[model samples]
Target: MTPLDQKINTHFPGLVVRKDLVRTVKGNAIVPSYVLEYLLGQYCATSDEATIQTGIETVKEILRKHYVHRNEAGLVRSNIKEKGRYKVIDKISVALNEKADVYEAEFSNLGIKRVLVDSGTVKTH
Candidate 1:
């Protein structure tokens, strides 16, 4: 097991995410850090520290390679269409109305408003 993984398993059994690790992720994309960290959490939640570190590097590589800037939505959309699937980091917040029967995605800085996102897209930090 990697040292970080051992530390997390020993000290943070109930914590699903380690936000402190996100700072190690390198990128210039404008999206909130949590978004990238969320993706990292998915792949790097390992009991072995070395594996986790490798996974972290892999996820950072993905962000550095694929994440799009706000002004490049058209390029990103085309890439997504061509690639058939993609993981994007964007600022998203949740809103609950009176009825609470609906959900909307507020894309920060992209100027996209009220787009619907599946509940599955929401991840717990």
Candidate 2:
């Protein structure tokens, strides 16, 4: 870590991600760069090289397990149905359904639509 890097890490721990490491963690996933950076912020925020490497593996594992791919939408849906609930990372768009008088969410990559969302979540997010 250089002097500037060390200074930044000192002042803003757990909020900084090394720029080069972004490419290292980003692998063919269609998600935006901010998403990857957010994950990196959680795990690779420190300037320690060893910790950053371990965090990179952790972020990759998280993407492999939780990220929803467009091609595997059916499988992911099946898994969610079978398991009752499952956590996934994907782009979501929420809108109020005028006809139903309810908030609904659409998962872009997961290919799921009309999933009801609570008003609180809809407002907060």
Per-residue lDDT of model 2, residues 30-110, tens digit only: 767888999999999997789989999999899888889899889999999999999999999999999999999999999
Q: What ranges in model 2 sit over 4 Å off?
A: none
TM-score of each: 0.52, 0.94
lDDT of each: 0.66, 0.89
lDDT of 2: 0.89
TM-score of 2: 0.94
Cα error of candidate 1 at position 111, Å:
3.1
